[model samples]
Target chain A: MNILVLLRMVPDVVEELEIAPDGRTLDTEYLRMIVNESDDHALEQALILKERKGGKVTVLALDAPDVDDVLFSAVAKGADRVMKIEGGDGGVTTRAAAGMFAEIIRNEKDLQPFDIVLTGVQAIDDLDALVAPILSHRLGLPYLAIVTKVTPDATGKSVTAIREFAGGVRGEFDVPLPAVLGIQAAEKPPRYVPVAKVRAAMKTSKIESIGVPTMADGGQPLLDVSHMRKPVVSGHAQMLDGEPEDVSKKLAGIFTERGLL
Target chain B: MSGNIWIVAEQWRGKLSEITFESLALGREVADGLGVKLQAVLLGHDVQNLSTSLGMADSVIYVDHTELADPGASAQASALAQLVRQQKPRTVIVPLTNVSLGTGTLLGEQVGAPVVNFCKDLRAADGHIVADCVLYGGKIEATVTPRGDLTVIGLWPGSRPPDKGRSDRNPPVETQTVTFADQPSVKLRSYIEPDASDVDITQQDVLVAVGRGIQSQENVALAEELAASLGGAVCGSRPVIDQGWLPLSRQVGKSGLNVKPKLYLALGISGAPEHLEGMKDAPLIVAVNSDPDAPIFNVAHYGVVADAMDMIPTLKETVLALRG
Candidate 1:
């Protein structure tokens, strides 16, 4: 019942993102990184499974500026072990990352016993949603995505997952052990780890690092942004200017013209 | 290995999903750019009638099997992989839904083709294909080129209008069969369909949709008041519902209800593709957010770079004054 959780650090979306001088990538000078929201949920789901089934939880993340803090936080939240894969400046494509992950899992002799591997269904930074599927494919395991719930069978041979489909439809699946899933959300919101506990975990735990030579040797990402510009808003929406009251009045005036009033 | 472009049409319960038609539209462009035929591969039991619907393609390849009537990822991937290996298409496109992601991924792995999901744009450039993909919830876009000889792509739904097949003649049809081993790795247990909600927000003329920017459940009342003043219904994005501030029935997104109102007032909604897909077709979109770079502004006709907290109250007052 051992579980492996793939965590990712993404640039915080709330902060203003600026294009670098290169014009194709984000300006990393003042960029802040945090755990990808869905990956946080995946880690939470893994911790919940461990708490219920008495299994070890191992968290894996690509090395990024704040990744050690994220791994330590996972440990504070009940992850048994955490490892940071070295390489990737947070710009690695999902396909290439999956290749490195598959390579690591295959070559790391001590890490081969995980019964299930889970990752965020999609990352805010990449939005490719291909890593789990590609990883599972490379490892020859069954793959499922948008999973909201996972339950182990009493016999411990299979796990049942509830997958969320478009339009609120939910499908329950019985996937065999040694499967991979793209978790959409945990059953509960990720539990909060107090700063004290995270500090203690930082002092007590050490993060193992795995060196990755090149994510591109076998699975190079073919896409690169040639240029980026602010998306021009379509539909020609009329922007209301001025103070809040004045803009609100203008909006009401337009609504009245439409006779909605 | 081959120049032809192929699209794996997704079907559920004997009917082709709209996404299948959309993929064809996208594939048509890629195929024309490559000066190749756009072909469709349909796999299902007794799906002969469905092949005719793919008039957008030059031809159709049908793989029939009983197990495919209720196909899982393994079965679908196995069948598609065999066909793809034999046909050796230059590129294969499938819808990036919860179901077909596995098919695309597994087939790519089996054939040593790299897979990229949620492609927003595709082009044939200098004898190679390139795709524009979004990251950071559409905040950043990256261009990706597949390295392998073969590429499998996952097309995002609503990327383009579904192609209307030719009314004059049906596309040529070719049938292929695949022998798939039993996929015992995953089994379908049950389906938990959501109950029909009492209120159908899709019928409303106006919808005030709130997101995480609304801050707290207490602030939701302000949005409700604004919605009430405008004589519209109040809906929310996934976060609000997840926080128990709104009912699941009132949630609007790919995983929630789809609404196409005359006016969609998005408050604090970051306009993730999920939420945008549900309401992008609305006639008029007005978005209010504190972040100027929020993706919602890209689609909104009218946007105010202000907090929903300040705007909602003033909006309500103005609406009430108009009513008076």
Candidate 2:
């Protein structure tokens, strides 16, 4: 079985953002990048599936030439091979970056018309969470988003996966082989990246690079951000002076007065 | 087609959600600025007459069918894509629900256009719509131009104000029965809706929504108190339901009850477009978060940058006093 996981490298979400002097964009410097959080889970889920069923695992990402720290980490943890494509400077939107990655996947001759594919339900960076479906369409494969679990057959032909619907109802799908499944949070985080094997994986693993694809339809937001500064709601909120019950009542009253309750 | 703002008026299972009307309200804001006709594309199963409410549009286009009941990404995208190919509206606005997320992005890709996945800040100018949205767990806001060469945008639910009024003026948009595959990869053989005997938090006039910002299951009482003081119901984001902190019925998001209430107080909630899409129709939004950086403040009209825990105590008292 051949398994492909879409790994994205994004600016460390924890880092404070700096707005350029001009409000139109954010400054990319002082930003540290890492493998997307949910993609980490995607890789982990792929690793577990490989351990039980035994398939070659490939992790693909779009980033600058030097996203090797995170790519090496992916290898140390599980991936048999890591492919890094030069898709401009890293950390673009899901629309732009996924186009580049999809282009790379379509071009790769080594990958055995993948038996199954997986990605996080939503990447932490773009939060658009729309790519897996788009990728599924672009690849002409069926897609199921927010899949909680997957149970595959030995031949990698058919699989039954649990998907969450509205109101906690779990629906099981009898999906055919070679479908893309976007994984949500799983029962376990990917197994830790052991230090002993980390050095060897980094030394031996080859990071294959590729070219970026042009984005077709990036949407216009009616309102554009003047800057990428950290969110700031600057004002001292009035503390309602009272005890618990009284405070509760007072808060309700305040909202009512404002026609908000 | 060349100079009109495209509004995909969303209706599901015969009824239009409040966000549909709200989109028209926001759409007009774009239409007026672009100095073009307002076009509303209404999709639903047997919703032929539903387009009547969208009288404000210069043209109200209708695509109705019973198959739309099970609208999925591929089906809806193919239909909307056909409509786009024919009309070529300057911008397309879809409500930011899971189905919308799937279909809107798919259409964007099929047409090779940019789509604002979710945006609170949506405006149109110079034959283009520009949007700003938060990504990366509310860490940073990325500026997007929906009109950029080929980009179109999906509307962020709670960020835009609710509909105040719409025009009674009328001109019917030409109706077309879009021919796309209505095939759901996974067919819904039947829908076993939850027994309506159960009370849903979304129906209540007031909702005290607890987000991940709230610490533990035990701390839910702080939010419950506020709910009690206002004679309202309480709900939580997905994690709360996932953790068994609240009944799954209390979960609010794309997968849960969409609500439009008089008031919605988001506590300790970092507003994801998923959660916000469900409640953006609430007439008044107030948010409380310790981290001023939380994205909830973006759409919130009245917010206090403070710990929701401490603020809940004081706010509850304020509610009690006001109720008195």
Candidate 3:
């Protein structure tokens, strides 16, 4: 049972995002990038599966700001191999990204015969969340999204996935091996690796860099962004100010007026 | 290119989902704008009667198959793709939900059409469709146009009023047939429903919602105390529920319960679109977060740019003191 997990770096929404001068993209100069929350869960799920099934785990990521740190951290978290694909400056669409990944998984002789491919269910940037399904379609394999758990059968020919639907409804499915899954959460929270361990792993681990393939004409983005801007603040909220006590007093007054208290 | 507009009606457990109606409302607007027919595509086993409620569309395309009864994304996409290939609808609208999340993308790939997902709004612009899509959890908005004539749009929930999509008049139903080339590799085993023994957050009039800003399980007690003093209940965003600080029953978001409390006190919640979908309709919403730019403020009636941890204790005391 060999597992492959895909990691993506997304703009850290904790920091303010400013539109670039182009008005069609984010300003990359001051942007802080972090591993997408759900992608971190995908890596954690892959590691858990490796631990339970005695298989090798490989983490793949496209090139982006602070990507090296992410790959090194994956090594510290018990990933057996880390691979980085060059030439992604964080502007690629999900369709194009999926095409690149499918190419690598099929053409790369070294990363052959993977039983499973795991990726985040959705990224904040690409909320469309099309990569896993498009990739699965390209690879001619089964695909499942919003999966919380994966358990392999004794024969290793298939795996059972616990998929979540809207409103807390969950469905269990038997997916044959060599499938793609969009992970919503791992059974456990992502494990934190110490900086020292990452540093140590960085010294011993080698990140195999793969060059970007020449994409076909279909790789062109279907959706072209005409403009990107911050949401217009309606200023609907009557902002309360001052010390905590003062604000609390005002809130209490409002609640009393509304008969909530 | 002149073509019909299609809305893939989402159904679960023999009933159509809310997002289906939302898509119909949106699809109707786009269809009328483009001067094309609005068609609702319903695919399920023994579910032809579901078409009666889809009067919002000019017509309903019904497909019946046992394999589609509990279909995976692939089976559903394949069936839809077969119809799309034959009909060549200019735009296919799919609802972005956990059940049909992958359908649009899979259909786009299968039919060689481009997909624009997370679409909150769509309109015909100069005989072409344009979409307003939310990005980065509603921090940014992008106006997008598809480069191709035929495209798939994944409509997000809360995009339109579901009431506008409901109609008493039955639409003409057109039955379609599709055969799968191969058996779907994913087979449903069983559905694990949520725990029903816990409190129903939707019934509460007042909900004090917490998020990652609450930090730890111990901090949840603060929210609980605040809710208790207010004669309300304590609920949380997905982060807090995922962290095990609260039960799944207490989550207030898309995957959780769609709550419409009279007063929604949001503490530390940033108000992602998913979270907003559940609670934005509250009669009164007040939010407190360290980030003044949190999207919660967009929908909140009153907001405070302060730490929730510091405000919770004072709020509880103030409510108690005011009541006295």
Name the candidate that leads on lDDT. 3
Candidate achieving the largest TM-score? 3
Model 3 C-alpha lDDT per residue in residues B1-324, reported as the tens digit of each score: 339999999998899999899999999999999999999999999999999999999999999998899957899999999999898899999888888889989998888888888899999988899999999989999998887779989888988899988999899999999998774488899998888898788999899999988988999998899999998899999878766789877888777889999999999999898899889989999999999889999999999999899999988888888778
Please, what are the lDDT tens digits per residue for candidate 3 over residues A1-261?
A: 799999888998879999999999999999999998888989988999988998899988989989999999999999999999996555887778888888888889888889999999888877334779988998899899988888888889899999987777789999998999999888777888999999999899999999877666546777778999999865668899999999998998888898877
lDDT of 1 at A74: 91
Candidate 3 Cα outliers beyond 4 Å, as residue runs: A88-90, A127-129, A233-235
The residue pairs that clash in candidate 3, if any, are: none
Worst 10 residues of 2 chain A by lDDT: A215-224
User: What docking grade does candidate 3 earn?
Assistant: medium
Model 1, range A51-123, lDDT digits (tens) per residue? 8999899888888889998999899999988999886555776767777888888788888788999998877
What ranges in model 2 sit over 4 Å off?
A12-15, A32-37, A44-56, A64-80, A124-129, A149-175, A187-261, B64-67, B134-151, B159-162, B165-173, B181-235, B239-247, B257-268, B276-290, B297-324
Write out fnat for all predictions, comma-separated.
0.63, 0.28, 0.83
Better of 1 and 2 by lDDT: 1
**Model 3 chain B poorest ten-residue lDDT run:** B179-188
Against the native chain B, each candidate's TM-score is 0.92, 0.77, 0.97
Error at A159, model 3, angstroms: 1.7
